[model samples]
Target: MTIKRITFLQELLGLFGLQERVHLAWISSAEAQKFVEVVTAFTEKIKSLGPNPLPAYRDAPRAALAAAAH
Candidate 1:
């Protein structure tokens, strides 16, 4: 079930060229080391990908409106 959800989410993100940002992992609570490793790797991957553009895209319309007001 979780895999199905992740696949669907990946497809949705793919439409926006962000499918790589999605990750699925199964780690037991007892395995803290594994958890740290996975998180560290994912963080590095995100850093390598650079910043997300969604914030700028989301603010564009507001920026245009402000410019028009001026």
Candidate 2:
């Protein structure tokens, strides 16, 4: 149910001309440096993209995300 709820919100946000999305999770018990490296790479990937790739999706107003959510 939580996953469904978040998916819905992500889709809703996507509809607002900000569809860029990535999801990451970590267990607090894990190593700190491991977390750092992964997030660093994620940041780099986001930086490379500059901003939203699904500019068209935004125009469609989260319709894609809604389909995906289901």
Candidate 3:
């Protein structure tokens, strides 16, 4: 079930070129170290990718409108 959800999200994100931003991991509460490692690695990956472009892209129309109103 989790795999299915992850797969669906990956596909959906792929449509916007953000598939790499989605990660699925199974970590138990006892594995604190593993959780930290996974989070650190994912954080580094996201940093390497820089900020997400979708926000800017999504707001472009609004920005244009605001500029035009000025």
Candidate 4:
């Protein structure tokens, strides 16, 4: 289940050209400060990038829900 979620998000990011364009971080509970710093940077970088390209995923409705249901 964990593997699938990561793979799906990675693919989704790649589809939107944000895979390499953005940085992904998974900060632990003890790393709140690091989390804030990385999240702030990520938001600023994404803001500068303008719009998202994979908005079509919503067109399929429960596409993600279905994927996770498996």
Name the better of 1 and 2 by lDDT: 1
The sequence of per-residue lDDT tens digits that candidate 2 reaches over residues 1-70 is 7667766777887786344455445536467887887788878877876866566566876767787673
Worst 10 residues of 4 by lDDT: 15-24
Candidate 1 TM-score versus the reference: 0.75
Pull out the clashing pairs in model 4. Answer: none
Best by TM-score: 3
Residue-wise C-alpha lDDT for candidate 3, range 30-67, written one tens digit per residue: 99999999999999999999998777757776764576
> TM-scores across all candidates?
0.75, 0.42, 0.76, 0.47
Q: Quick one: ranking by lDDT, best first?
A: 3, 1, 4, 2
Better of 1 and 4 by TM-score: 1
Instruction: Give the residue spans of candidate 1 off by over 4 A.
Output: 61-70
**Residue 56 of model 2: what lDDT?**
53
Candidate 4 regions exceeding 4 Å error are 1-16, 20-23, 54-70
Please say which candidate is ahead in TM-score: 2 or 4. 4
After superposing candidate 3, which stretches have Cα over 4 Å from the reference? 61-70
Tens digits of per-residue lDDT, candidate 1, 1-70, equal: 9999999999999988899899999999999999999999999999999988678657766764575473
